[model samples]
Target: MPSLSQFSRCLFFILLSMIVTQCADKSVEENLADGIKFTEDRQYLRALDAFQQAVAKEPGNPKAHYSLGGIYNLMNRLPEAEQEFKIALKIDPTYVDAIYSLGFTYELMGDKEKAQPYYDKYNKLKQKWNEVLQKESETR
Candidate 1:
């Protein structure tokens, strides 16, 4: 019951929305890889962008937020790093890296006392993480 011009406009809007959504559907893995690659290359800003995209894609992915926090920490954006690390921990309580980063963030914030518990947890986890890595390396 619509006019030709009206129908064309509706179709155009629908097509545009579909195209935008498809473009936005990129996998979180792709974004994470891009982020890591950029981080390795020392392109911190680009890495941050990629990690942000990954977080956008997988809002529940603690690792994505942790990676972003790591990048920010490296860049000396302590507050931003702290925020992202906190968010990552909120999403995943047992995330060792986030806990470690938060300890560092507390240090940066001049709250050594707040950092203590996190530091203890990180040290415990780091030992285990290192052992796992060593075993994996021996296997390789």
Candidate 2:
């Protein structure tokens, strides 16, 4: 019953919405789950593939970057590990695991000075978490 222009406009909006929804279905969480499973199985290459897929899906996912960094650290690829950890940290500065891993990566690379600050941050964050847990337990 609509005019030609109105029908065209409605069709365009519907198509646009579908495209946006499809693009937004990036599967970052699914890939992360697969990566964790592969990593737990000690299948490094498979884990890498999964994590890489996760990163591809969501470049801003700190967990994907952190998982990639952890894999690189295990493989003795210190520079790549450091870079991934830095990326994770850049995406989420409060990601404690990434902060700890960055310190550990620097230590592995023999950069004690670089490692020290991260270690301090890791310790501070751990302490904060512990205190939070303590307060929660006290209240309950």
Candidate 3:
């Protein structure tokens, strides 16, 4: 049997881990929001830091990747923007914004041919989304 001290230590560590995880989740959201605000203010470096933090905390989050990509695009860092947008799309293929942004990035990089397909995909997805919204409105 574990000693009382050992049991207490184990329980304390478990509780600490739970608290850390909860805080990390909230931090990621806060970082993402802060990044957006910074971007709106045109503080690209600060926005980059905040978005990078969010991405680090939540590597699988498409929104974080998208936001980071947007900052890169604004800074004219086309390659980085392309990469982040691609990662976002890979995480969520139906992310319309990422799809559009990737195409825009490609266009900015002077690759209209590569951009065309993504633009097409974005348009099709938008049309489908609008149709769904229209049907929902009709039902209502």
Candidate 4:
């Protein structure tokens, strides 16, 4: 037999699971788009909600992680932003934008040592991407 607190905890988890399941019903892209729109509208809380849903729906999606990180960064949630950006890099190591943003997050948090490697990676990737674009344009 469960005690009152035990039962309450169980009930809470059940409700939370149900909510998460319902949120997962939406596609990751839909959530990401909603997050972007909400951010553009300056609705930070709504944007956070959408990005969180995107992350829950697609845990391995780098874009979802990046979007979530961006929202956290905008809201001055530095630790959460760092975590999400790191997750994005874990999912896609060559995610130059996330690398750049992670560096920026660290800089904002006053950790220049931690920011250096990410900034270096971002700069390298940006240069390579630019070269590719330039070559493509030359061929066109």
Candidate 5:
């Protein structure tokens, strides 16, 4: 059997390791919230880091990709923004904001032809969403 002092030290180390692991491992939603807060503060680099962490934690999350793309767009990193938005759309084809942002990013890149189809898709989706809202309101 272990001595009392050795057992206490071992338990203390185990608890410390658990706390450190939990601190190091932020949830995807926590990272996303941090990114949003950083963006609101105009801390672009910190926002980028937070968004990247969110993406890493949940690569299939369209919201994470969309939020990352929005930061890139605000920073005028149009090509990267376009790529992230495309990834988001790949994960969720009906992601309206990503569709609109991708089109806007293309326009910013001076590629009007490329932008048009995305813009058209966004408009169609928006129209459908509005119709759904209208029907819901009518039922209520």
Candidate 6:
């Protein structure tokens, strides 16, 4: 069995971890919001840093990755943008924006064949989603 002091230290470490995690979560939210604001303000580098922090904190968020990909694309960093888009698609395979943007990235790279398949997929998904939204709008 462990000593009382050892148990106390262990508990402290756990509590500290919990606090740190909470702080990380808040920072991620702040970073993500700032990223979008910076992007809209045309501060691409600042936006990239903020988005990078957000993705580091929340690796599973497809939207964060997608937005970062957009900033990279706007900066004409095609490879980085494609990587981010690929991550977004991995996180959420049905992410339409990621698929479309990946397709667009290929187009930017002058890879017409790769772009065509993704473009067709984006069109089909966009149409399907639009139909769903229209039906919902009609219902309401």
On TM-score, the leading prediction is 5
- Which residue pairs in model 3 clash with each other? none
Q: How accurate is candidate 6 locally (lDDT)?
A: 0.92
Error of 2 at 128 (Å): 1.1
lDDT of 1: 0.91
lDDT, model 2, position 17: 99
lDDT of 4 at 130: 98
**Worst lDDT 10-window in candidate 2:** 22-31
Off by over 4 Å in 3: 1-26
TM-score of each: 0.70, 0.77, 0.81, 0.79, 0.83, 0.76
Model 2 C-alpha lDDT per residue in residues 21-129, reported as the tens digit of each score: 8746758887778878888999889889888888887798899999989988887889999999999999999999999999999999999999999999999999999
> Candidate 1 lDDT, tens digit per residue, 60-113?
999999998989988889999999999999998879989988998889889999
Top candidate by lDDT: 5
* Residue lDDT tens for model 6, 18-37: 99887576676788889889
Give the per-residue lDDT of model 4 (tens digit) for 12-114.
Answer: 9999999988776888899999999999999999999999988887899999999999999999999999999999999999999999999999999999999
**Which ranking of candidates, highest TM-score first?**
5, 3, 4, 2, 6, 1
Cα displacement (angstroms), candidate 4, residue 61, comes to 0.4
Q: List ranges where model 4 is wrong by over 4 Å.
A: 1-25
lDDT of 2 at 42: 92
Mind giving the per-residue lDDT tens digits that candidate 5 earns over 1-140? 89999999999999999998985699999999999999999999999999999998899999999999999999999999999999999999999999999999999999999999999999999999999999999999
lDDT for model 2 comes to: 0.91
RMSD of 4: 7.2
Comparing candidate 1 with candidate 2, which one achieves the higher TM-score? 2
